[model samples]
Target: MTETLTTALIEMREDDVLAAVRAATEAGTSPAGIIAGLQAGMKTIGDKYEAGEYFLSELIMSAEIFKRALAELGLDQSAAGTGTRGTVILGTVHTDIHDIGKNIVASVLSANGFKVVDLGVDVPAQRFLDAARENDARVIGLSCLLTTAFPAMRETIATFAAAGLRDQVSIIIGGGPVNADLALQLGADGAGISAQEAVILAAKAVEGGVA
Candidate 1:
């Protein structure tokens, strides 16, 4: 886990957990060990945010650092054949450039050994479907920060259903404007308040079996 983190951190140097992942992986740490470290770090960051010790800008910076570290580790390939890891398609809905939460979720999922295919911000419903098809992802995560873009989230899920892929993957959603009730209404499998919580929800979705 430590090794996984080291590699992940190296790839996602800008984000908090990803860089830590690289540091831990380089030391030959196990995947589980790396995840534990990331969970701790994410919790710390969340606590800081709750206490007003940090702001959205700081959170965004941290997420960037984590993202770079994950890229450095080539986590997409490393996650394969790892029993606890699985592939996920993640994106922020169209017309919304805010990706702080999406980026954080991607980093945490990557650190936890999940292969995350992040479709960056302002992603269209078609692109989300394309990514899911390309990756054969079992999980689909949507992030929407703007209230106006909220409908895009549902459209993405509906697109999956239209393509006959909805039942094949578990859809999870979050971000500034997302709520559990809304997500459920949109047909998502679950919702999370933070990226760490998203990772946990994704894991549960995976464990319960996608589909």
Candidate 2:
């Protein structure tokens, strides 16, 4: 972790984190290195959220802060498409309008060399499948903030299988109310508890396609 940036991010100091990111970028720090630091910070923040030390508001605010840091570095999703390692289709599951986590995943993935097709929030299963098909994406990320959206995730996976693309593309799930067991139960490739882990999962999923 970029110690300064991670500390500022853990404390939710937006200005300080941005300053650190800028300083690091100017010092020729690789975007991947900088993102690793931010990712560590995000993991800690997520831990706090899971421990009940942080509320939904803090979790949302932290994601917003991270998004801004990415934008400051020009490595946000806008810069994620050039010379991509692989394509990933990402979105909030149907009936789930929350997008904080999904946005963070997109930013992180983009900064880490992935091309992300973000489908935004409340996206249907067919939309996810269609985007994956259209982009030839090898990895799909599903984010859900509400229990109500769980069914949609299940349906999304089922839709992929029904389309005969289940074995073709890897699917990963994340966000509140989702866990590793739930991911297995849904028959997904994996579950990401944090943005950094999501990157790892996506990369591995793409590697699976390559192999």
Candidate 3:
């Protein structure tokens, strides 16, 4: 059943994936097991995207399937924070309206037991700080697909530093234009090329370690 779910997701069969998730749930499959299967599928999808076997449209479709499966399993925002390992505030930095990558990261993190406070796209630096402070998040993830948003990422990090909260939380940046060096330059603790890596980085961040 799990394999079916994974296959359905990897194939971007939205209806099939939804059916598989529903069937698994009715069969009393654990939510964690279902989520793990979905993550496996997403990992394959990510790899295909990187290898150029899948394009942006396909990637977006896969993400949508993943989200639908999660919703079918009753594990969307309402289920966030339940048995969570920690809280993470995530958003696209100012002037960036792109959110596909950020949404994927949020779903993966939430599935992995991290409560995600998604501040949405085109978010300002101050809003990130406010959400982090309100949730006492252990990590902040900034997403930006445009090179022009690098400065915004820097400003977001600067705001954290200016507020004297830099040390209290870890900052990680992602999206097409972000890299480890860029993250460092912007005062972030780390950067991830994919949502899977972001989950690992966020885990390390919560443990007071950098990835």
- Screening candidate 2 with a backbone cut-off below 3 angstroms (N, C-alpha, C), the clashing residue pairs are none
Question: Ranking under TM-score, best-scoring first?
Answer: 3, 1, 2
In order, how many clashes per candidate?
A: 41, 0, 0
lDDT of each: 0.70, 0.82, 0.83
The candidate maximizing lDDT is 3
lDDT of 1 by residue, 63-159 (tens): 5554454455564334422225678888888999998778777766664557788899999999989988887788988888888987898899899
lDDT of 2 by residue, 135-190 (tens): 98889999999988989999999999999999898899999788999998989889
> Relative to the unseen true structure, what is the Cα RMSD of model 2?
5.1
Put the candidates in lDDT order, highest first.
Answer: 3, 2, 1
State the weakest 10-residue window (summed lDDT) of model 2.
75-84
The whole-model C-alpha lDDT of candidate 1 against the native structure comes to 0.70
TM-score of each: 0.66, 0.66, 0.73
> Which candidate tops TM-score?
3
- What TM-score does prediction 1 earn? 0.66
Q: Give Cα distance to truth, residue 117, candidate 2, Å.
A: 0.6
